[model samples]
Target chain A: MSEPILSIRHMVKRFGGLVAVNDVSLDINPGEVVALLGDNGAGKSTLIKCVSGVHLPDEGEIRFEGRPVSFPKPIDARSAGIETIYQDLALANNLDVPANIFLGREAKNRYLGGLVKTLNDKWMLGQAEQSLAALDIRFPSLTQPIESLSGGQRQAVAIARAIYWKARLMIMDEPTNNLGVPEQQKVLELIRRLRDQGVPVILITHTMPDVFAVADRIIVMHRGRKVTEKRTGETNASELVQYMVGALDDTRTSA
Target chain B: MTDSKAMAGFDEPALSAGKRAILLISRLWAWVFLALMIVFFVVAVGVFSSATFLSVRNSQNILVAIVPVLLLGLGQTFVIIAAGIDLSVGWVMSLASVLSAHAIRAAFNAGVPLFLSVVLGFVAGVGGAALVGLVNGLIIAKLKVPAFIVTLGTSFIVRGMSLLFSENTTVIGLPEGIRDYGNESLFYWVRGEGGGFYILDKPEVSGELLRSMDRILAWPVVITAVVVLVCLFLLKRTQFGRHTYAIGGNMQAALRTGIPVDRHIIKLYMLSASTAGVAGVLSTLRFTAGSAVIGDPLLLSSIAAVIIGGVSLFGGAGSIIGTVIGALIIAVLTTGLVMLNVPAFWQFIVVGAVVIIAVLIDQSRDLILGRRGRGT
Candidate 1:
């Protein structure tokens, strides 16, 4: 790891009297693949929302590249090279692949009234194709609407889009949950490829096999606390579950 | 515009999990706009000039004659796009016009620069509307009041502001340059018997039986052209335009994607109202009167044009082209009805019918298209 991409200290989030995320500290270095595993109502979504700038933390400090940062809007997060692929992916089904890839950012010619007044489809389509190809996606065509792609193909396209836009940190919330078995495998391969390409990824999932398969490090959340942080090779599934259920804290002696 | 990745299969779990944005240009509304154009032209020509009604000059005159309303229509596009409405836009126009005339008179007499005063008056009109729009946006976005209630209230407030200035009196003095914009043509003027001076403008077509309409060219037509072209650029080419559509389409999804939804809506309201103010200035310049009362009839007319232009009341699916065409239709219908000596009250009846019919057409098309397949 060349540098720490994300560093959080004493991060806390509250919804009225409800403590959704308690004082928790975590860090992810460049090119690292960290998995955040938790059961339902374990504050996974709330924590994700805080990180993705959907909700502000009540008390906390978030640092990107050692500089203090707070995002009031998701655009601030995205512009700073942090891209979150939401559970629903947030892809506009009505937009074509190239259009979707360039959503909110259509390339334009600087010179005004240049008779060829249109979106830079040539550049966008080329990039979309290259991204899908780099991620080994088997989508039908760049011209097809994203809705036409299978679930896994869509996930691949999403990962490809994030990586294409030069995201140093990709936050994927259950990229494989709705995907077919083969699609899950495709996403697994995409995750490993992202890490190998020096793009750090934050994989939030409850799937034990997924955690064991690609995560270099694991952070288990139980009732809004980071109960465990261990290397994938340093722990087994049962110990991770105990940490997730809040029965234990950071002790990987079982593995 | 920002949420490109919220894509899910129509039946996928992702679809059920979070709301998504639909980015299609809305084919149903486009078709409805086309139908309105056909109906408007047919009715106007049939009811008025049997032979010269659908001629090129007549159509062009119709297009040019309605340029002021078309400008006002541009403002309506923004307000409606932001899911807000401005009933005060008409009064804003009248106020802007009277102020411009009063400024011109003051500048012409005091040895001060009339150019600066004209600019100042222009700014006053836009600034006044913007002030009201900001309040409208603040009340709607911050206070959680419905857009209708806030704007409806502010409309009266703005109208009262204009009344305070006008005092039931039309401003008397207007500079030559301003009036030239409304009355003069570079190549020609439609001169009548005994050297009567008039441009080939609105009052002509509805008055005399024209052997040819091409001979009657008005400056408003030129104004309409420049306005439509600029509006198209703003709506389709710029970042602000994209933001406007995104806010209208699905605001929640836009927010998750990091769009500044509130600021965007506020800017839209300002843009909409300010454009109406500009229209008022032009109308004042054209009529050569600082009449504090302008566009009283235009409140309904401005909104009708936007709706009939194919913009959905739900927002996010319209073009400047559609709006211009819609404005032309309204002006032509009015002129044609007057040509038939139809009572002005009946004109209101006709306009009301046109509005209801347009909405119904839009709704029915939505039904027909809704039953059909979904494509990007």
Candidate 2:
């Protein structure tokens, strides 16, 4: 991989003396899908939070674009071209899909010599229509609020927000956990499409189908440590489970 | 985009922006109810008593009496919109009156320029009230305490301060200019049309009013109207206004959207107190005498008018015009009862019942509308 897009080195985190993530490290390369796989208490979410700047690692270094960086807040992380699409999808239900897309960063027009500013509704709606189309998200009306949309459609808007911002790295936590078969396939297709467009994604999930369907590399964690790392093409789902349970390591594999 | 469609509901483009300019004004219906009540009271007075039931002088007197209370209601709207209540309004009024009275008397007795003491009194009253408001905001925002408890505590504190300073006494003397600011006619370009007849009494602002209508509007009423309009514009049009609604609606949702939630809420609390100070100043100037007990009775009515105006007790919903109408409804009801010679004790009962009924209606509308949305 040509100079990792995002690199983590010995990342550690604790919550009231409970070592949630103890000295873990991973690298996400440009145009590559890295799967951070773990079971319930494997510290996958904690590591993702550290990378997304939601929590400051207790002891570790996070390098973005090959330079060591520290972000005090999530907005700082976003401004640095790192965006996280959370599982809950924090889109305002009362607002339309377009409105949800350009919510905080609203386009404004200065009508009276910059003394007065107004929401540029026409411009934002047009852009929302385009972004929704580019993502292949079909909604009945461009003006319908997100609450009126199906679960898949709502997820589409959240993904569209991540993509439209043009983030260099996107981290999705459990992107397909609640999705049915068709929706899961749709999301998988969307992930491959995102990779083809040159944005690296960190998919955090325990579903082997999701891992096999998209990941270029799989990193398994148990307790608070990274136990096994392998290229996805060379690995099998059953063997990955052994590493997750600490019955196997990266060095040894048993049938 | 057409006028009827725009008025019927909020269409895409607002056509009423220029010609009619009415958005969020469904609140004005209550004000119409207030006007009707006034007319009914006038009729009742004419039929039952020998005293002239209605005349230009009595009509204007009723308006003047209601003006200060309306100011208080307008100020309270800001606080309520921020999901807060200001129970300190009555105390704030008393403080303003005492401070202004003392300042006027001291400066007048101490042989200083008359205007200087009046200004000093205003500054003292408004400034003290604002300081307490700031404290209220700081406490509520920083400690994350509920607003109702904090304001309630502060109300007793300020009330105690007012009593201690006044010693339950009344300050009698006040400057002419300060008093006239609230009471004076200022101008009456025409007296009246020499009447050809005097029959059944009704507000005859036709030629009779037209003959005397050339005068500039009273400054107090003008001031109150200006404050209401500015507040309406700010709450309905500005970014801060939108933030206020968002915070009141759901603080967590607002914060996630990157709105500076705590600061905005605190500023809202302070704004409420500051406007209460303005009303207090107006009240002090109107009454002339600085009674230690000034505006004690206004608390319940001021709040009643605000809630009745269609301002949601649940917060996140309400309008300025609604508050004005609510205030007017309360005002007209009180005045109408007195004009019809209803006994003082029955007047409170009547007003209290009206307040309760209005609040119940407002509460039910909110309950229905809230369940309609997807739990915003």
Per-candidate TM-score against the hidden true structure = 0.74, 0.74
User: DockQ for each of the predicted structures, in order?
Assistant: 0.18, 0.16
Model 2, range A108-134, lDDT digits (tens) per residue? 778679887766667878888787666
lDDT of 2 by residue, B1-376 (tens): 1232112121133122432223223335466667777678777877887555356555566556666677677767877766678787778777766766777678777876766776777677777777778888888888988888988898898888777776575776676667766654544443545433222222245755655443234556666777888788767656666566556554555665577877877787666766666666666677776766776678778888888787766566677888888877776677677777788888778778877776766554434333333334
> Cα RMSD for candidate 1?
7.1
Writing each residue's lDDT as its tens digit, candidate 1 over B1-376 gives 1221222112243322112222233334544545575576567657666644565555656666686788888878867765567776777777677676666677766766666766666676667667767777778777878788877888787777777787574776666666666655533333344233344443344344333223444565665577677778878776566556655654554565556677877777777777777777667667776666686667788888888777767765567877776786678777666655678888778777877877776666455334222211
lDDT score, residue A252, model 2? 43
What is the lDDT, from 0 to 100, of the residue A204 in candidate 2?
92
Task: Give the least accurate 10-residue stretch of model 2 chain B, judged by summed lDDT.
Answer: B5-14
Deviating ranges (above 4 Å) for candidate 1: A1-19, A22-33, A49-80, A88-133, A136-161, A176-193, A206-219, A227-255, B1-51, B111-146, B173-180, B186-215, B252-263, B332-376
What are the per-residue Cα lDDT tens digits for candidate 1 across A172-192?
998889677756766787787
